[model samples]
Every structure is written in structure tokens, then in C-alpha cells.
Target chain A: MLKLRWIALFLSLLLGACSQHVVLSDDFPEPIISQLPQPVVVYISPELRRYVHRHEPEQGADWTIVFGSSQEKLFKSVFAGMFEEVSLVFEEKAIPDDALVLTPVMRDFQFSTPGMSKSDYYEVWIKYSLKLARGGGEPMLNWAFTAYGREEKSGRSAAGAMREASRRAMRDAAAAIVLNFMKQPAAKKLFSVAPAAKAERT
Target chain B: MRCWPAAFALLLTAILGGCVSSSVEQLRQAPVGVLKEGETIVVLGRRQNFRHQTEADFTRCVQNTLTRKKLPVKAEQDFMDEMFPWFQPRMAPTTAEALAKRLQEPAIADRLKQTGTRYIVWLDGITRRGEDGGSLSCSVGAGGGACLGLLWWEDDAEYEAVIWDMQTLKSMGKIAVEASGTSYVPAVIIPIPLVAPTQSAACRGVANQIGEFLTKAIQ
Candidate 1:
């Protein structure tokens, strides 16, 4: 009995040292923006809904970070505030007629711990690619951007700090998209009204 | 009273070694105006700089101190949630001029009014520890355990707050604080710490000045 118990403990310790996994929660808040009067549709992809970052180094613990459902929630909340009428479609075929379509994909995810960086902070970097198109499959624009986040390790556990850093990186990406999207020439042409034309109309 | 002796002892010890020296200043750029009923203020800290990020606890201290002084203060997290990306670290305006431009946006302006926020204080700065020149050693044996030697360091805290009157979309004033102190840990058999509360002292000084400044601004 004693030998069996010792063997069980050793195996459990070995398993514990081999891998680490984390599931992230949603951290996005609905943004405040000047709403476009036009109706818009967002296509949420299955790949994004099941996005997971797996890291396996040569001599370190394997890490897996699951961002399930968080990305979809973020786009839903963000687009809800950006348009007068917003619709979410899980399938590409479900997009309605003549609606502006926005699709976002997670391109890459990377992170560094205190042990790796030799600093008292945990950092995460995320890359995103966003596409805007018409429901009829005509592409308007594609924008790629990167976001960085860092959290201090003073009073937080390693996992907690890394999770927070990841959330902050997502918010950074959201902020970038919100701040610059409307300023893009394509989007500007879509949303802006000429002052002379407006005056004439009024 | 017994309290007198304890207070005197504390003052003497602070005078002798571990004590904080602090200063506060305010720069008025425009005349103060009424804060008005239902209007509140928010203290926000900057985090965009790569070199340093303001301590979260320090900002909380400022908010709590302001609240303790009976000033109408809004929780920064709630305010930021309502404001969202506009007040994010990457999107937040660092200057009053930029803030004025942002306020021109109808949506943001409406959100600000809905939150009943009339004053926005941009707070920034950091605390640093340096000048370490001491050693502490401890040992335990069958006979007994003892610790001998001394460890000492210096800490400095500096902060600044830029006050903007959102109602007028102009900066009302600015407040600055600088505090420094030395902390010592000496051990004979055990460690005796004479620590300086430098950060808290700066927090109190800045909060006091802001409270007074806002009170005077009230019409």
C-alpha cells in the first residue's frame, strides 16, 4: 500500500509539471461612439470562437490559452454601439442584402512571463486582422494591427497577472479599432456627409 | 494624557531618522467655476508611458482620500467603463487641448453628461526606491537564533494632477506633489523597522490640495 501511494504521488507531480492551461473571461465593455445610421452585419467565425494559443517550448511547460466565446462577445458589444442596427451572423451565407459586413480574425498571440523577461511584469501581445466588405462579397478594406499589454506582478499570482495582461491587450486592440476605423478613407467615404451637400439638402 | 507622550515620542523618532518631507503646489490656468449639484469629479491615472505606470493603489488612495473629505468623487473603473475606448490608455488624451477636441464629439459629450461628470483630473507620476547601503544577517543554531546588522534605503514619491473643468472644456488648474524619506531596518536580535510612509504622505497632500481647490471652485 505504501509503495503504491508513493508511485501515485510521483506520477501526479510529473503530470502537474508538464503543462499549464488557462481559460480567459470576457473583459470588453460596450464602447461609446457616434452611431452610423446604416444597418451593419458582423460574421462571427467558428475558428475565432474556438481560438486557442498553444505554446510548447523545447524544455519548458506547455501552455494553452483558450479564448472561447470572448471574441464574439467583444464584437457584439462593440458593434452594438457603433451602428443603429447591428446583426450577428454565425454563417457567411446568412448575411442579408446590401449590408456592410465586418469580420475580425485573430492572427497571432504571444506572451512573456516574469521568469522569461527577467522583469517584474507579465506581458502579452496579440495581432488581429479586420476585414470590411459588402454582403455581396466585395471587399472594401483590410486592416492589420497589433496590441500590447503588461501587468505588474507585485500582488497577483502568475496566472492571474497573465490573464489580466491578456485582457488588457484585447482592450487595446478594441480601442485601436474604434479610434481609427471611422477615419479610414473607405469608412470615411461610407459614413461622412459633405457639408455643402448637407446644407443644400437642409 | 497617555496619548501626548506617545505622540511626542513618535514625533521625536520621525525628527531623528525616518521621516517624510513633502511639498504641494497648484497652478491656476483659469478662474474657478461652480461644481454644481449632481456633478462629480474623477481622478484618472496615466498608463501609456513605457518607462513607468502610476500605481493603482496610489490612485485608489487619492480617490478614497477625496471621498473622505466629502468631495463628490466618481469611481474611475465605472467612469471608464461608461466612457470605454475613449479613456483607454492608448486612446486617452494627454493634454487639455486634445481633451477639448474629444469633447467636441457629440457621443462622448453626451456620455460625459449622462455620467454627471464635470471635472476630470489627469493624475500621473511614480514612486522609486534607491540609495541602498546596508546589510542584514541572521543565523540560527542549536544554542539560539540571532539577527545582526542594518539595512536602510531611501524612497521618493512624486505625483502631479491636471484638473480640467469638462463643463467648459478647459483646464481649471494643476496640482503637484513631491515627497521623499529614508527607511531603516536595524537588527540586534531581531529587526526593528523605522519606515517612512512616503507614498501615503504624497497621496494625502495631493488629495488635501485637490479637495481645497475644488471647494473653492464651487460657485
Candidate 2:
């Protein structure tokens, strides 16, 4: 009886060993795009241009351009090509004359628009930065664009591709800026927009 | 005397065999990140600004995957409502500890402590963009490689996901993947035509690449 019991126990143990399965943690699913809108045209803010040219004299102006945009489609196409979704914020700062001169100027311009909401104008601000950097002369422009997007809800695979696209966008923008600056005429024309002068009536 | 000796040997063999088999079975059944049998694992869920429908789907997928793995999983809500009352509300660690305790089948009120969870996966962001001509490429290697390259510029979408270590709060890794091809397929249906010949191909391509990276990291 004891021997039989031992045999049964051994057989059960062996069977259990063979039947066991390896277990892994749960995997998150891929993110799905419920909707994708058409690409909106990105434009530079007029107020930003007025700010940059406010105090400068027009004697062969050296110009710099920085770009920003908030249009979802433009962001998806351009900004998404440069950053990961985890990045909640993007910022670019320019230093002129070894002092943080341009940031305050940009900051004041960013908040200056009263009619439009913050989000609507954010995209405008981003686009202006890109154009300004192209136009600014001998000007060092730092353009930082940030994005907050869908993450693992779309799965890790989707996120990886998105990050790659974002990095590419940033590189492309930088290259475009360099290429534009190499051309002297293009650079000069960027900041040639003149300030409104006081008119005297006879 | 001969029979007696044979019986003794048989009995010893059976005892040794049982021990070996039990150990093997325990090891085989162990969950990822668990070092020993009976060790507990904790499943955690994080809240983000995601669409409700998407959130439900993601939650279901994760829960199903975990259940299939046979790792005891406790929802965040259950852990909060029943397991650990002493833990401050909205605290992730407390909830993690509570869940770990449940996995171990411990006394409900006993202070169940763990080093940390095996994995923490979270969503980061999603985006889409249209591609231009400069983005397309074709190779002339073999099967169908010599076909005309299609240059389509439609908005491409991407999703970013991150995995972290629960205890140390150190980021284990991050994966960002873009939607397959340039076509916009609504999220509700599994790609139409039964198999999305192109999008499915693209999704698999991206999945394989990211999956390989993830597997290598975990191993």
C-alpha cells in the first residue's frame, strides 16, 4: 500500500511539472486614432513680428527665425516628427548680447493677443519662431517645441515609431533653418517688415 | 532479503522523483519577476487624460492578458476599497502594496510589504502626420521588390508607451510606435477586409521591432 501511494504521488508530480505554463504580465493595447483632421495652414503671429522689429534700425538687419505651431494636423506632421509623447512642454530661448533679451520679448508677445485663446495662439507662436529664425541675421535662435500626446494606450510599438518621427521633424526644421540662413537675400527679407510710423496730416 | 533491498531502493527513488518534479513544476509556473513559488505580484493602473472608450479597451486588454498568464490580478478599485484602508487615498504605493498582499493570499489586514512590482506600463501620447515624397523608399532585393514605389502623403499617427520598475520608480524603457501606412482606419473596427493588407503589414512591422527591443530588455 505504501509503495503504491508513493508511485501515485510521483506520477502526479511529474504530470504537474509537464503541464505547467510560463506566465507573463499583461500587455497594454495599441492606441487607436478615433479621428484625424485635415492639416491646418500654419502662420506667423503679426504681433510677434512687431515685437522683434520694434527697436531695431533697418540698416541691413541681421535676422533669425524660430518656429511654433499648435494646429493638430501641423503638429502631427511637423512637431510629432521631433518629440516623444511623454514630453509635455517644448520651449526655445534666444540669447542676444550675452543677456536673455529675446525670451522676455517673446513672452510679452505670447501673452499680448487678447482675442484668441491660449491654445489657438500657441500654434501661431510656434510657427512665428520658425519664420523668425530664418529671417534673423547673425542671430542665434533656439527653438524648442514640446508635445503631450497619447502613450501606451496605443501600445509600445506605436509610441516608438512616433518618437522616431518627432526626432526627424526636429532635425529637418534645423536643417531648413540652416539652409535658409545660408542664402543672404532670404535672411534679409525675413525681418524687412517695417514698423508703422506716425503720419502727419497737412 | 533480495526483495526487501529492491523495495527500499524503489521507495527512495519515488521520494526523490516527487521532489524534483514538484520543484520543476513550481518553477515553470512562476510569474515573470518572481524569484520563488508563492511570491506575490502586483498589477497597477494609472489614470491619464485618455478617451473613455479607448481607456476601457486598454483596460480590458491588459486584464485579459494578465488573467491568461495566471498571475493573480486585483483591480485598483478593489485594492483601494477593500485591502488597505490605512494607505492615504490617491497614493500609488499603498495600492501596489495592497495588491501584492492579495496575490500572496495573505491576511487582509496584515501589513503586506513588497520590494516592488515586476512591471509598470503606461501610455504617454498619440500623434499623426502626413508623409511627403522624401519619406518613401523602395529596394530591389527580391520578391516584389522591383515594383513601382508608391508615394502617399497622408497624416501618420503615433502612440508612445512607457514601462517602469514599480519599486525604484526608475524607467525600465519606452516604446513609441506609429500607425501603419498612411491610411486612417477608424479605431473602432479591426482593420476592414478581414486583414488590412497594408496597415496590418505595417502594424506587424512596427510591433516586431518594438517587441524585440522589449523582450531583450526584460530578459
Candidate 3:
């Protein structure tokens, strides 16, 4: 009876292992090693907000596994590294009188299956349109960034591969935003320029 | 065994009876309000590649069905021509949000308002053939002709109709339609192909739902 019980337990464990859903980790590195002088507010575009929350996969693709936080939260974490203060907002709200706003639009996020051989890598790609707005002035900076991630392990199932690939792509995208937006001349101007000083209390 | 002919007839009827099936789901509900007299709702395909006849046929079917239900819908071609003249071919917004924002712009907003467009129906989706498998073999021998094998394939399509409320410049709601079926062909000596009206069937299903949704006739 004990041997039979042990066999049953082993079988259960094997089935459990086989049926486990892929879990990805959010290990996106901050783009900027150091913080900026002031905080930058981040707004996710309405479409992007809905899309991330919807989490609908394209046909023929397996379910996507997001690591720890939702896409919005993950984005907040990445942007938090860009400045001393980072605020993530969903709806269009009154921005701090002096705050610069960064709106990120997810134009496309795609996951592709592996090649004929299951060992082949799966591809994950993300496209972002980052719009920098200051005090309702014409968007000061409009940049589009595309990043790709590949899963090379043969053993990882398609969903697992997608998770890894998507995680890496997000990280790569964050890195690009940090470097491109922070280091650019316009971004410097944005950081240094004081929000139109409130009519000097005259 | 003499009843085999009757059995085959019954079998064929059964197989053909379930050839096409589609369902509509309201992912978002339409806002409560009556459209003003003479006000129009516009139907448009959301992709450039949709200029093909198949897409046009789908769009027209939806418009006609809605019109039949007493909803005032604008001609897709007219809407496209007036709004997106620069593109030569018709153009559609990249995203629903973008279109919403565009509709709020004075230039575009003024034009759309002038046309009395209260709701914009975005028809986006594609009908496609899906997985297929089977084989057919045929040959004429000295004794007679003999053929044996099976040929089959899948036909599937998905469509989403996202309704935008021009008044609020927001998405009122959306409806998604999914249809899929398998087509079979049998061969005794020569391959006989059975083509399914997959795309046409999907078109009708989506159009029927749009009609029902707009008319608020859905139960």
C-alpha cells in the first residue's frame, strides 16, 4: 500500500509539473543609473491602458505570461528610474503645474511561435511611441522605439519562451527610453527648464 | 445494405447542415440615447488592405443590414472618400483611441459633425481559411475507375466591430464575432471538393449582429 501511495504521489507530481503555467520574472534594469533633478509624470495612452489590461493575444499564439506586476506597473517601475519623482496616471488629469509629462503608447506587442523544431527560439517584439508633453506645448519630443527578445532554450515551451522573450523586450525598451530621453538635448532642456514659473506672485 | 444510399443522403445533409456557425458577443454595451432624426452612423473598414472586394462586400453587407433595421448608416465609400482623400486609397485610424482623438480635432470634428455622424462603426477583422488535411487518389484501370481518400480543410474568421460615440468621443462598446468550420471533400475516383461559404457566412453573421445591436433588438 505504501509503495502504491508513493507511485501515486509521483504521478501527481509529474502531472503537476507538466501542467504548470509559465512564470516570467520582471528584472528590467533601470535605464538611468542615477536619478534626475526632478520627477517626470508618466501617462499611459488610453488605448495602451486598455490593451495591457485586456491582455488579448493574437490568434495562433499561446497565452502570454507577464512576470510580477501588470504592464502598467512594470512601466511605472521602469520610468521611476528616469527621474527623482515618477507618477503613473491612467486618465488625463491635471498635471502638476510644473511637471513634465511622458505619455507612452504601446503601438505593437507581438509574440511569435518557435520554428518547426520546438528547440528553436521564440520571438517577442515591442513597439513604443513615447510622447513628451510640457505645459500643453506641442509635444516637445516624439520618439518611437522597437525592441526584440529571443528565447534560445530548447526545453522551454512556447508560452515559457514567450514569457522570457517579452520580459527581455520590455527591459530593452526601457533601457532605450532611459538613454534616449534622458540623454537627449531636448530632455536636458525639459529637466532644467522650470515649469513656466507661476506669474511670479506679482 | 440496400439502405446505404438513403444513409449517405442523411449523412450528407447532416454534414452540410452544420457547415457554418457564428456567434456575436457584446464586449461593450451601447450608450443609452436615441439618435437624432437624420443622424447617421458610419461604417468603415479599419485597414488599408481591406480595399479588396471581400472587405467591401463585408462592409456593404453590414451597412445594408443595418439600414434594413431602420438605422441611418452612411455609405462606407462616401465616408472614406470625404475624410481621407489624401491617401488616394481609403485610410483608417491606426487605433480606436487615435480615431477618437482625431474626431475631437476641430477640422475633422467639424466635418464629421456637418455630416451628422453620431456614431462611427469601425469594422476590423479578416476571414481566412484555417487548418486543412486529407488526401485523394484517383486512377482509371482496365477494369474500371477507382478512387479513394478524404480531403478536408478548415475555414475560420474573426471580426470586431468597435462602436465609437461621436458625442463623447469615447468607445461606447464593441462586438466581436468568431466563425469557423470544416469543409470536406470525398473522392471515389475523381476528387470532389466541397467549398464552404466561410467568409460569406461570417459576413452575414457579423452584419446581423450589428443590425441587432444598433436597433437595440438584442435580447
Candidate 4:
């Protein structure tokens, strides 16, 4: 009976060692960009703020990754720094008149492990879709971008590596937003070109 | 008992008997100048290349080595955060000229001044495994276990440091280090691996030269 108990304990320990859980709640630094000379409304949806990912490896136990409030913090820091005046809104109707409304949706999240990829790296990729409109009207510009991050398996735990890779992926997404926002022609039309239309909206 | 102690010492020496060789070269474009008070240097790893990216640990290792050698270096992450999207992988300047032109922006220029950044060292390159040969095998029985074989491999590490004077908006010079070595593992009932410190030797070589280059006041 004691031998059987020892075997069971060893099996359970082996199973426990294969499971991993990661929670990301860290804050993103405020981006440094020339503030848009217009008022902006950032809408953070519940789906984006509280995202969770779960996956099971080939021979290991389940892996759960909880995004927590990182998405909310990222959008907050990004839009607040990009616009002169900023307001956080949950609903579309609460947007102010003549202000630009930016809404982001978490489209897809994927990750690959070293064992899976036959590489010595843990990688994370995040896809985001952004909707841009004026005063909660029809969407003037719709765009989707993917961001990626990778970390080498340099003696870090599975969960620790995944967490760092996820944060880098989020930061990469934020960079995509700040660096590519002004490059869109439709976006440029709304943010820069239409003085008369902007005056009316104001 | 004395023989046992001598055998243990021999084993210890064998475990640390890794062989490594290194070379360092530098090219200075302008006269070496002295650092001003309240000035800080930033050692940043360049990641624009898709084929090879400078290892983050190596970058930090250089930073730590420089610190131990008494050179002031700002934390790369903090410096990148303060610069924000400007220094992100997608937006960061690839060339010294591009960096100088980007510094012309008032906001970026002011941030550089506010952060008291005088020099920016960009680390680029990767440590990769070279040709390797040999293998080992092990076998076990109910009463005993024993293995006998030999394994060996080679490692190559090459890195370059491009120094840019942020204050003058000029390329100060470049420093390159190359290091290579072979590792061995011989098994006689037990495997005694002799690992090479090729990457570490390259890191130290670059860091020590950087220390000498920055500290000297030839201007």
C-alpha cells in the first residue's frame, strides 16, 4: 500500500509540473507622440479588457493565460498621450460631439512554444482591429494590424517566458497604433485635411 | 584519502578546461571627447534584422560588465520607455544618419536633452553555433549503469558596437569583437563536459574596449 501511494504521489507531481498559468496586469508606459490637436474619445470594450486564453500542449497539462486589465491600460496610455483632450467612454452614445472615437477589438491571440516550434523561443502574436469615426457616426476608417513578440528559452520557466512575450506583443501593438495611425489616408483626411468639416463638427 | 583528493582536483580542472580565442578591433571617426557632468550613456540592442537579433541577455551582460568596470549606463528598457514609440522596433532609426535626422524634431530633441543622453551605443550581432561533430551514448542495467563516448562542438560569437554621439548628432566610431572556441564532453562511466565561454569572451572583449574608448579624453 505504501509503494502504491508513493507511485501516485510521483505521478501527481509530474502532472503538476506540466501545468502553467500566466496573468498579465502590468501597465504600459505613456507613448511620446505629438498630440492630435483634436478631442478624442477612447472606448474600451469588456471583451478587450478581460481577455483569457487557454490551450493544452501535446503532452503537458492545460495552460491558461489571463490578460486581466492590460488591454485597458494600453489603450488608455496610448490615446491619452496621442490626443490633446481625452475622455474614456464605455458606450458609443456617450461620445462627445465633433470628437473622434477610437474603438479597438481583440481579434485573435496565438502563441507557440519551443517544443511546438522546434525552436528555442517562446512567441506570442496578437491581432487588433480598430474603428475610427467622428462623433459616433459611421466608421470612416477600419484597420487591422498584427503584433508579435518572441523570447529565447534561456532557462526561464514556461509561464514566465509566456508572460514576458505577451507583454512585448502588447507593447508592439501599441507601437503599431502610434506609428501607423497618421499613415492612413482616410485617417489623415479626418485628422488633418478637413478644416471646414472639422469646424462644423466642433 | 590523499589520492582521492588529487583525483577530485583533476576532475574539477577537467570540467573547467574550456578553450576560447577572441579578437577586438575599433575604428574611430572623430577625436575622443570627455563626458560632461549629468550625462548618461545608453547601450541599446538593435532588433531590426529578421534573420538575426542581438540577444537581450548579451546586451544586459555588456551593460552589467560596463557597470562593474565603473562606466555609467542608463537602463536600456527605461531609456526605451522614456523615448516610447520613437524607439520601438518598428519606428527606431536603423542608421546613425537617420537617427540624427530624427533628432531634429523638437519633441525628440527636448526629450534627449531632458534625459541627459550624451552617447548611444547600438549593439548588433548574434552568437551562433558553428560546425559540430561527435556524439555520446549511455546504457543502464538492473545492477549497474555505465556509458562511454566522446562529443564535441564549436561556438562562434561575433558582435559590433556602433557608437553615436547624440549631442553632436554624429557617428563617433565602431567597435567589433569576434570570438570562437570548441567544447568537449568525454564520457567514462560519467560525462565530464568541458563547455566553452565564447559568447562571454566576446562580450567582455567588447565591453572592456568600450570602457577604454569612452573614458579616454583625447579631445
- Note each model's CA RMSD in angstroms: 6.0, 28.2, 18.7, 4.9
Model 1: how large is the Cα RMSD against the reference?
6.0
Per-model interface RMSD values are 7.1, 27.8, 18.2, 7.5
| Docking quality level of the chain pair in candidate 4 | acceptable
Arrange candidates by TM-score, highest first: which order? 4, 1, 3, 2
User: Tens digits of per-residue lDDT for model 3 on A22-95?
Assistant: 45545443332345657677876566645541233343323534343445765776676546688877677656
Per-residue lDDT tens digits of candidate 1, residues B1-219?
545545554554455567789999999898767777889999888767255678888889999998887888999988888888777778776655676777666667777887789888888888999688789999999978877677888999999988888777777888999999888776666666889899999999999988888876554
How do the residues B188-207 of candidate 4 rate in per-residue lDDT, one tens digit apiece?
66677788999899999999
DockQ of 1: 0.38
- Tens digits of per-residue lDDT, candidate 3, B1-219, equal 535644564466456543777787876555535688767888876644213213555777778878887788888756653453211122235566766765665646665777678788888787776888878787887977756677788888788888887767778778888888778776544445667777677777777766666675222
Q: What is residue B49's positional error in candidate 4, in angstroms?
A: 6.8
**Can you write out model 1's per-residue Cα lDDT over A1-202, one digit (the tens) per residue?**
9999999999999977787777887757877765668888888988898999998998777788899888888888878767779889998879876888999889999999887889878899999988889885877888888988888887886777877888888888888877777767777787773321111100
Whose TM-score is greatest here?
Answer: 4
Pairs that collide in candidate 3 are B147-B188
Model 1 residue A31 CA deviation in Å: 2.5
Q: Among the candidates, what TM-score does chain A have in each?
A: 0.88, 0.23, 0.68, 0.84
The alpha-carbon lDDT assigned to residue A160 of candidate 1 equals 77
